[model samples]
Target: MDRKIMSLGKSSLVVSLPKEWMQLNDVKKGETVSFNIQRDRSLVIYPSSIKKSEEKEIIINVTSNEEEILITQKILGAFLNGYTGIILTSDNIFTVPQTKAIRNMAGRLYMRVMEADAKKVYLQSLTDESKASLEQAIKRMHLISRSMCEGAFTALKNNDVALAKSTFSLDDDVDHFAFFIVRILRNAAQNPYLANELHIDPLDCMDHQMLVSRMEHASDYAADITRHIIMLSGANQTIPGEVIELMITAGTQVADLYVKSVEAFFSKDVDAAVGIMKCRNKLEKLDIEMTSKAFIGPQKEAELVCGICSIRDNIKRISHCTFSIAEIAVNRAFKII
Candidate 1:
């Protein structure tokens, strides 16, 4: 709602607050309200008493026939909708799979299972939304995903099955961050006060939401690369050294580009972001050259060749994700510029 500006004195100007808002907050003529000047120079007025809002609560009724995947989605849906208290109820008792699914999803969402009985389970989120840092959380998310790419390539380079196995667990960490970031962004999108506290506008929230999704996807490809690596690096099955070295070098280059993209995003460096887009040219050329020579030398076994190609494809997919990230970085930098 718009308020008419009134001259208070020679230099001061004032605007009256809406009566409806004042009444809702129980503000009287003498009581003071608080306000914050947002980054865009807009003011957000709120009650001075600063009463905490009650956490949103949701209930999920679990039937014996409920699909585990559906249960997981229900919990995540509640979380994204800004619910902090989730209760799962069953008519009888939860099956082992049902209980396990709830526990796993609760852990992933940074929630604690506060209580569980034969017929019901209660989960509460651990983090205080008002105090969480969106930037730090996104940074942590990017760190894990970027590390996953590097780790996957390194695992392939060294033929370390143990290291390759870590991609699974690392991907889970990335997922946690993704979920956390999305939830925060969703909250910020709906609450202007929260957005000001988080130092993000609606546009920033949209960009972050998109970027987190890309990071999650890139991490998935990175994990896929590791799975192929594990398969090809088996004792009885080895891809040629020439093939491995080529894949490693190119994959590592992709990881480097991924790093540059995220750095450009953080720094708001338009030049660096544009440069990342150009660097992909060389990587793509290498992909072409490598594909041509993939069957040459000792790199010609049917199974090994297929596995090498799959790994290469996953690496290329990651590069695509990086390119999208750089594009977003360029746009974000322009917003500041």
Candidate 2:
């Protein structure tokens, strides 16, 4: 059942809970509980004597001389799957080749080699990359995504099929950017010393590569939404201006989330990521509300609604993909802390 809390004074407040909750928890007039003030300004109450689970130790071993691609895959997979600690070891001192790749990967995973020996190197994960390449790549992705959104909006607003067609061609640019990221990763993985000389690690480079891939997919989704908009407009001979505006607005929100999420990922900003996720929910709600509005005729309404629905679904999926990338960033930040 729903409950309400109200402020009573400067320092005191009262909360009314369902009688059922009171009985289920065995609460009495004199009972006490713990309270927490959430970021959203809501108060949470809990039993004071709740039990907590003990933290468990986890260890993973990585051997030196492992292929860079294979090593990165292993480390990232382990990190995502919840390994608490990782230990890299070699029979002798870490060679230049092994050390460079390992350091690169460590940077990407937000992990550090806490202890090292001829036989073992213990790592503590952390998310901190104050590098130009990473920053630039994120910025470019935002710019490109925003541009695509703007182009799509223009096409939809003016019912310009030519402009809409142009938006599909823009996907080529995004693909080019993705290829650039792949090339960077390939080079870094192949020559660890070059990465070391540049003061970056192969693993860190790989993380940036993954970020690029996600952004590229975001671009693809945006393009597909634009293509659908074009098809709908072309097929119907005309689309309601309001419907077009609604789609443009939704597309803009998607772009905003894409940009903000990428910024949060690079900066390790959890609040920013959370904000983007909330905004995505708002966009989804807007799509639903707009879809419910009726059009002039049955045939027109059906076509427009179907097309808008497809665009809406794609936009939501794009927002979700951005959120997923943000989640990875948040997880990386936690490992560091």
Candidate 3:
């Protein structure tokens, strides 16, 4: 990948473009290609302006015997893979159920049906990938996920069954944002121009992807804690007051740690990330104590213990996920400095 820099004149320096790249991009001697100086001080050459997005077409063959869910997944996969246009075709007329399913799937995505008939359906992306940004998507996920975590603790504190049940609904919203972020990262990995437009390299996209995945998992765990609370409430059994207070305290603290870790990542603050890491031991010890007390408590029904254990495991998992984010933040901080 290294090339020798040749002096053009008294001050100017130049490097030869690869012959293969020149041929592939149809570059002539007098033609211009764009060059960008990346955040890491690396230079990137593009055949055209990064603002000009590329379009991709994908054709999916649907079989009558194929299940609707499988077909839907294929359609979603193509969309997520950055295909700007998709055509779903079958040899025979699509069944009513199949047609309905396809429409539902397309509706859920950032696409619109261009044309639909008995044997084929055409869908085109409504999203302008160039206008979308990974940073904004990640921030949105952080806000929604933080709300989910907070909602779980609030439900537990008030023994509010309705609020606990609502956590699952919030988790669904988190899933949608996570899915969008993942799609953006996947697309960015393949399209350097798009990555540059987003102010990130592929490696940075990957790191942020890992952070998004962990946050999604943490959100799921928050919902799990709420689910267990709902179940316990339904059975007229309640967690001990001391244990409830402990769980709330631990969950809130872990949520704060997650917030700080994310802030460190965005700000490239190594000390803040390290500070979050320092709280890990205390969270782990508290997790152990919660488990032991839940197991040997005075009114330990199998069902109650099961719920307690699930909540304990998930709360612990949230803390671990928070620490993982801090770890990523620390790595990014070092790179930035």
Candidate 4:
């Protein structure tokens, strides 16, 4: 192959590819190729001409006598491994124990089953529910988070223990909404038509499912902080009002960052995702400051310090989860960036 030396800069050298080699590969000017660095620091390049792997159809067989719990695990496992279909059969007519068990389990898990014959059943994936359900769930999650933040801040500002306790209870709603999202996505992944209708790729849908999971965990953190706030307000004790205000401000900032990050993910906005990363960095700095001031001693100081540490840790974890979601959005919007 012909090669020509080229200058990259005053301190660097480069080489040009052979024209004949490019032509033989049917590569035109400006075509892109894949490149990688090996462990030995050698560079390897391949023409971007490889084809995608073909999707496979997988089938699972289950018998009527099989325990329902076992069948449920198998179904979930097969779906996760990219199975396209499943078949259930029995030597005799399906018994009430088996049918009833499967039906109960399917309803609980949001899966669908079709009886193809006396001894055979077909299983399909789940999907997102009607638009009303989706919209309502999203709204509830937002409202719960907003209320929790408001209650926590107001309680801290006014030293209202009752309000703080009430805020902690709101975490139940956040957790419920998160579980609902997971159930919907799990169902969608099982049914081909529903998955397609929702525009969710079975594999890619896992990321969205995880985002919801992390948000729930973040809410748990928020609730934990509020609980501590309640404790401090009672027993005639308090953190410096200014410190409490700072913690509240940090928590609110993190919540806003998480919401924007979720929006960026849904909209595939790389710029917004990057903005979230910046906000997370700022939150981290504030956490460090809160931790330092939380440790000054009295009889209750240790408990208060530990509680502040836990709150900061949870908030930082939430930020990290938000960043993970943002990373997915960035990858989608700019594949090579």
Best by TM-score: 1
Clashes of each: 0, 7, 0, 6
lDDT of each: 0.86, 0.64, 0.84, 0.65
Return the TM-score for each candidate structure.
0.90, 0.53, 0.86, 0.57
Candidate 2: clashing pairs of residues: 104-201, 104-202, 104-203, 105-203, 110-126, 111-125, 126-336
Whole-model lDDT, candidate 3?
A: 0.84
Give per-residue CA lDDT, model 4, range 1-337, as digits (tens). 5467788879898777777777887878898876545333445455677321123334556665677778766665655444434566667777777777656645544456754677777765443242325435655776687577556656666767788888898887786576556655765666443444455556545666766766676667667767877766554566765567677778667777777877887688999998887776678778878777666554556666666666667667767867887887787666422
Worst 10 residues of 2 by lDDT: 49-58
Q: What lDDT tens digits, residue by residue, belong to model 3 across residues 77-146? A: 9887888899999978898989999988777675789998889999997787668877888899889889
By lDDT, who's the top model here?
A: 1
Q: Where is model 3 poorest over a 10-residue stretch in terms of lDDT?
A: 46-55
lDDT of 4: 0.65
**Reference-based TM-score, model 3:** 0.86
Tens-digit lDDT track of model 1 for 174-272: 998888889989988887778887889999999989889889999999999888777766735776676677788889888999999988888989999
- The segments of candidate 4 whose C-alpha lies over 4 angstroms from its true place after superposition are 1-136, 297-300, 334-337
Judging by lDDT, tell me the better candidate of 1 and 4. Answer: 1
